[model samples]
Target: MLAAAAQDADREFSFNEQEFRYIADLVKTKTGIVLADHKKNMVYSRLARRLRALRLESFEAYCSFLESGDSEDEMGMFINAITTNLTRFFREPHHFDHLAEKMSEQFGNAPTASRIRIWSAGCSSGEEPYSVAMTMAESLTRLSAYNFRILATDLDTSMVANATAGRYRLRDAEGLSKARLAKWTIQDRSRNEMTIKQGLRDLITFKQLNLLHDWPMKGKFDAIFCRNVMIYFDGPTKDRLLNRFHSCLAPGGWLYIGHSETILEQRDQLIPMGKTIYRKALR
Candidate 1:
């Protein structure tokens, strides 16, 4: 009976290989994210529920609906359903430590140049950029005297919108200290939620961006925080993206990446600093 039940379950939801390939190709063309052959089950598992929720019959039908492009909202829902958003405040604290120290050193030398611009590439739900803002606010109490901006961008429009709202559950600040939390966030009396303080929110500008496409910024940034975003990309794509980042960063600017990724082969453009961070080679 158990064997028969297992067979029945397998037969109920098995995805056809052709359907998988079709979905994979469409996703890659739209987002530059490659779903490997082994991810067939993952794609089906994530999107299958969406299909049911939308009252669609099968994966093929859902594919046709997505291809038709009649409903932008449904397409967005499809993308959001498949995209993984795993992030937290103060993730990889060591990187922030490095950023704070570097900022102090830079400020000491060029005290007159008050403006500091940073871009948080692939900023998932704003935690990363908010973390940067909190660090700067704490370390630079005289920040008003200096111009500072954190441009946070993500490919996911929903994530960008959520980040722009600057609201989060209390649990999201678990890694933060009581002092930093008090300084950077305020609890909403009515909603029973915490919002990043207006000061911190003012320092950040969240936007939807696809790194594979042209950047919209007018000038280069002082530093860019692009952590844990390239693991999903192919090697050539990663290299090309890094090159673009190098071009967009000011001379001797910093690039922070995920700890697991290394650019040892691309050392000419990106000088290896300690940890996974690199500095764009000065021109």
Candidate 2:
């Protein structure tokens, strides 16, 4: 049974407190993710798979290798494996509703004024950005009237590549409405997979980016969706990213964070408008 398997899995790896702490420090140093004591089991479970894949026998050995210079190449795989990517189409629907409202306001006033730029930060597996694309595609009747671009970035390269592919299992469509699916996706029953067609996929650019590092983008965005991404970071990291996001926004731009996450500093820059939504003020 699953219980017995879990018991065996617990015994398979030797993760001491010191080893775990070392890993916590390394992950914190490299990725800005604060892994605490409560996450010990989760860490063991996730990294255990990595150990098996790498043909390593124990956590002690794995940790030793990780700290050594030999792990430079595998550091990427380590982060990718440990990083959580749980997401769904139209997740936290209110953000999408607010997004539609903003788009409506933009087109109603001046549809051809400027390029509408939206950034989906920490866009795991492309669902969030694709959802944005689909929402804009459906809402904007005069789609070609103005320039539009969405920049979707995540620290995980695998995630960015998958998002760029715009392909998913057909069963994944369960969360979306029938009409929405019909409009934005091309279903292949034989392959049991669905892919985002060219029209929808063309609106966005998927890139690998680390929020903690310098961003190559030199332009401002109208709206930035950084939902559920900052929960893992420490206060100073979150504060710095928020400040960067504030600087990256155009006047009257919007910033959205995860419902569970909150801004620890800099309340003066963003005025919260709705659930987990804040509008940027001109500075």
Candidate 3:
């Protein structure tokens, strides 16, 4: 027992198994994110800042504050702290390549087709949807003929705000080609930032959204980019989300997921089009 006591004494906060389990359960219940045993350190480190900010002494106190009915604002802070947002411009190039190639075939054949909708479900910051905008702008000959829009949403409100602002550091946009950079963004040398051009910004709507909750969109999407978001969820959550995506997609619409993600059970509903790309089976 002395060894265990010494180990506990080394910690900045008094974190025990019970408190960890409680936090894990709450996260899973509210956000569908499963915190495994290996994540204990990560959780402790991330939440320690909250303890300092709230002036809470221990993990037990933090857990109690969360359980209390008055933690609505704190809960939002907690979720923001827990959710990871690591993304860059065109992180996965192949997805955009496929989108560029398929745009003509999908919409070009139907000259009367006037609406093209794309949803970036876990759009971190703004890169993914901006990439989509670039592809759409370049692909279509008669751009003004169709009503094309991209919906970008994220669970973290801060991320949503950042995306809505449509501003980023120059280094963050280095991956983009010279042509895309020149055409789609305005350089602000004073601030060392680049603001997305009004044309690209006009095509996108960024909003805060929790994927576990009900989605407010009524219209079907022609393409959905929910990349890297499902890594946090368990098997059941992933399965449910895949089914939901299938339902949300327009007939023969496309779904682009993270490179690491796979569709094991939803094969019948979504067919593989290319690497990490799936198409909603036409009814």
Candidate 4:
């Protein structure tokens, strides 16, 4: 215990309980993310880089900088640091499988083209939306027939920019099947990078969005992929966010959440369709 205490004492920046609490409150107010007591070390580890980059002496100094009301850019950096982005292509294969099933149902009998909209509500680095597009491409043969589009949104501006760029390290796509990888992406074997094909990229529009704020989307979505995002929010925030998703979904549209997240509110509106999948009940 003494050795552990000594290691902690050697940390470059002094992070006190008050500073952690202040950061927690600020993050909650701004992003609806609950930083639990357990997240203190994680928060310090992440934010310490920001402190170093900004040349701030300590967490207390960083907090004061935030409080000064001129830290908008710093706030974005802070969010990007603390927000977890642990995602890969088809992190939950089941969700993509279910999406393929739904797409088949939607276009199986239709004689004419119809508009289809899907939203990847916390799209980290574009993988989720690109995966959705790939599923659509594989499921529906005639992509040109329908007005299909995907809206990918994340709170991190840098992530949004990266998503829009549509380029990723080749290793990032190792989870994808060989056929799918070749078909959907342009591989630069020499550079060890892959750029999503223009056709799939055309189907997506990337934007920076905060789920707690007013959503600018005027139309309801047929499928909403908000996986792994609600886990950070507290119970009430999660409930409210689920309710909003319920409102934003078209009747009979699907809502996919994180494997770890459960919908406890608006049961009347969102009916369980499968594991971690909910369908908006038709009125």
Q: Once model 4 is optimally superposed onto the true structure by TM-score, how far is the C-alpha of residue 53 displaced, in angstroms? A: 1.0
Quote model 2's TM-score.
0.93
Q: How far out, in Å, is residue 194 in model 3?
A: 1.3
Estimate, for each residue in 82-193, the C-alpha lDDT of model 1 and write its tens digit: 7778889999998899888888777644565477999999998999999999887766767767877899999888899999999998878777898887877897657768
- Model 2 lowest lDDT segment of ten: 1-10
Identify the superior model by lDDT, candidate 1 or candidate 4. Answer: 4
Best by TM-score: 4
TM-score, prediction 3:
0.94
TM-score against truth, every candidate: 0.91, 0.93, 0.94, 0.96
Following a full C-alpha superposition, what root-mean-square deviation does model 1 have from the true structure? 2.8
How accurate locally is residue 216 in candidate 2, as Cα lDDT from 0 to 100? 95
TM-score of 4: 0.96
lDDT for residue 114 in candidate 1, whole number 0-100: 79
lDDT of 4: 0.90
Positional deviation of residue 164's Cα in model 4 after best superposition, in angstroms: 1.2
Q: What C-alpha lDDT values do all the predictions have?
A: 0.83, 0.87, 0.90, 0.90
| TM-score comparison, 2 vs 3, better candidate | 3
